[model samples]
Target: MPKTAALCISVLGTGNIGSTFAFQLARTGQHDVTVIARPGSTRLQQLQRDNGITNHRGEHAELRVAASLDEQQPYDVVIVTVLAHQVAAVLPALQRSAAKCVLFMFNTFDPEQLQAAVGEERCAFGMPFVQAHVNEAGTLKATIGAGGQKSRLSQQRWVAMFKAAGLPAVFEPDMPLWLRCHSPLCVAFESASVLAVRRGGGASWQQAMRIARGVHECFVLIQGLGYRPYPSSKKWLAASPAWVLAFVLWLLSKNFTFRELLAGGVAECHALIGVMIAAALQTSVPVNVAAIQAMNPTA
Candidate 1:
């Protein structure tokens, strides 16, 4: 008989990231995917009825949904995709379960707190590198992660699974540092896009340039912190001067879709920038403090 191992996965959030992930796994026809949403969430009920999920340029067929952590046991891996606050509650619940692997597929720069809560043996971090959203109609799209970095051996299996599922992914040794460098640009550009929208600024090719500049600033900061900068679509940032970064932002403001898709989404960009600022404050690294400070809404 062939050696058989059961791989069970439960995602702790049912919004865009969670639902989309569930769909991704289900499409693989491998791991048994269960989405744990708040009890009696209408959206969960609707998803259960639809039994389907849509991704960028493709649609995943029907899959099952689970509404509680108590419904399953001995989960092989527990993927948490909830908001920052929701993580606190979910952590204790996981402590009550028999999950052997717990991976956070979203923002987790603060490793100490997470390791303390979930135990390092079961803890891992994943940064999905794509702009995605779950509209009111329950459609999903944009499932991608860092194409530039690779995770440590400790995380290769899960990374391999994601790659096999056709999602762009990589497992990095220094996940925190990678997130630190990756998230700042994402946050700054999106937040700036939101600001631009309010000013009747549309997203254009020019706007893409601005977003690229913000990413460059983050790259500079990461290099200052002694980490390799990850690759992004912001090629202009690599070839141009800092002033050119500012100029690109001016151009991007004319494109409506960029503003609507990125700037108009959740406050992830703000949170990312906040994490970078906190890290800088803690380290006393003043690489782009003035530029970062100027971008601060309250500053």
Candidate 2:
């Protein structure tokens, strides 16, 4: 669809990611945007009370709000912004919905199973590079495509839609493999961030070394499974020397904004590690399970 044409969109999950997408899409005033929040969530109450989604500036995007998916209603697309762990619970609803397309925008090492359930033809994947949050008082604070960053979307139509909504997105040829390859580093970064938060935001060279080791093991395990760590940036992360990667991670670890974006990502870290180990069992991959497991958040 052209960027100017209107389409009915349902954004499931109303946390930072959901609200960010909803606010931007609604602001375009071309698409019909409806954001779904949990029935008892404070986010739902705020959306209803304000009767719209707001950016950090207190400006409103006059969008529709809902607490659940209307499976019977035919929507042009349903963009899921929830975490991978949360996807299972919403799968049944999505499976029953009449939406023409389902675009999942989140981190996941394994998306094939999701696509199997969602149906391959209509299923789409996206990796969000935006830094966003719904802060207190129900305001959205977000940064999109800063420093030439671009989110990767598997499908072209959705890419156009995100760009049209003022959210930067680029098309990826093999999103599933890209996500799989990206998972290892994502877990390392998130786990380190969890530990850093516990340390009161201090960067630890020691922690960086351990996380770097975990990343290397993760790369090895996935590569043994015949997955190419595509995208030049991820390729470098996978093939670089351990000490070099550690230094880079240590540098990023000191940035408050970087750590903040990775905060509360412990659940995702744990899940990705588990999936990695599970996938490794099918191959002769020598994964340093102990070293990788050390990155899990205890707190």
Which candidate should be chosen as best, given lDDT against the real structure? 2
Clash counts for all predictions: 23, 0
TM-score of each: 0.72, 0.95
Q: What would the per-residue lDDT of candidate 2 be over residues 152-202, giving only the tens digit for each residue? A: 999888888888888888999999988888887888788777777788865
Global lDDT of each candidate: 0.63, 0.84
**Residue 109 lDDT (model 1):** 46
Worst 10 residues of 2 by lDDT: 290-299
Let me know the TM-score candidate 2 reaches against the reference structure: 0.95
Q: Tell me how far the alpha carbon of residue 243 in candidate 1 is from the true structure, in angstroms, after superposition.
A: 2.1
Clashes of 1: 23
Error of 1 at 110 (Å): 2.2
